[model samples]
Target: MNEDLTFLVLRQLQANPKQTQLQLSQAIGISVGRTNYVVRALIERGLLKAEHFRNSKNKSAYAYLLTPEGIDTKARITARFIQRKRAEYDALRAELDQLTAEAEAEGLLPQ
Candidate 1:
């Protein structure tokens, strides 16, 4: 999975650990197979831990949680994600400004 997806999955897990793969897939707009693959990768990388427990509904389920290392990684990745998005936003803002100026110069833009 890409860094963006990894960061998103980690963030989602932090938000709700008890969510099932299907639920996560639906929430994240990814396929169930991709969610399953990502979860397995995280487990193998020691970034996430899957604990089986019986929920209040009396059904066995897995709660995907982050380990200490995972938490630390998540923090770092979140920072990076923020930086990337901010840079993209800045670029878009700059482009919009340029486009507006050009349009205004040509009298193609409304005041």
Candidate 2:
């Protein structure tokens, strides 16, 4: 799975382990197949542990619990994501300020 999708799956799984693949697909805005594929990959990587829940309403239902490693990965991914967003926001803010100055210089914007 791609980095963006991997991060999202981890986040969604951490939020609710009981969420079905269909529910996760809808929440992540991806296809069920893709969601399954990603989850399988995570399981293979030892990040997520899928266990069947007999006491649950759905007999075939499973919970995707995060391992200790998975939690650490999530924290790292979250920090990186926040940093990337901050950089993007700073760049956009600077561009907007420049555009606003130009507009004001041209009298297109009220001073």
Candidate 3:
């Protein structure tokens, strides 16, 4: 999975371990198959632990818990994600400012 998707998956799983893959996919705007793949990848990477839900009616239900390493990874990913988003925001703000200036010069808006 990509960094953005990985970060989002980790964040969502951390927030609610009990969420199903469908719910996670919906929350992260990804397909269920992709979500399943990401979850499996995380488990294989030792970033997450999956435990069967004994009380759940569905035999396939599981609670995905983040391992200690997963928690650390999530923190690191969060920092990187924030930095990247801030850079994007800054660039968009500059672009918007330039557009506004051009619009004002063209008499498209009041000074």
Candidate 4:
């Protein structure tokens, strides 16, 4: 999975470990199958732990918990994600400003 998806999964799980795969998929705007794949990959990487809900009658129900390493990874990923988004935002703001200036110069927009 990409860093953005990974960060999102970790974040969602951290917020609510008991969320079903479908819920997670909806939250992340990904297919349930893709979510399953990502979850399995995270588990294999030792970043996440999936434990069955013993009290629940649904044997398939599980709680996805983040390992310590997963928490650290999430923090790092979050920082990178924020940095990338900030750069994108700055670029977009500059572009918008330039567009506004051109529009004003062309009398297409009021000053």
lDDT of 1: 0.92
Better of 1 and 4 by lDDT: 4
Tens digit of lDDT per residue, candidate 3, span 1-111? 788999999999999999999999999998999999999999999999999998988989999999999999999999999999999999999999999999999999899
Sort by lDDT, top down from the best: 4, 3, 2, 1
Q: What TM-score goes with each of the models? A: 0.92, 0.91, 0.96, 0.97
After superposition, which runs of candidate 4 have C-alpha atoms over 4 Å from their true positions?
Answer: none
Model 4: what TM-score?
0.97
Question: Judged by TM-score, which candidate is best?
Answer: 4
Question: Model 3 lDDT vs. the true structure?
Answer: 0.96
Residue-level lDDT of model 2, residues 1-111, one tens digit each, is 676788899999999999999999999999999899999999999899999997887777999999999999889988888898899999999999999999999999999
Give the clashing pairs for model 1: none
Q: What is candidate 1's lDDT per residue for 24-86, written digit by digit as tens?
A: 999889999999999999989999999887555646588899999999989999999999999
RMSD (Å) per prediction? 1.5, 1.3, 0.8, 0.7
Clashes of each: 0, 0, 0, 0
**Whole-model Cα lDDT of every candidate shown, in order:** 0.92, 0.93, 0.96, 0.98
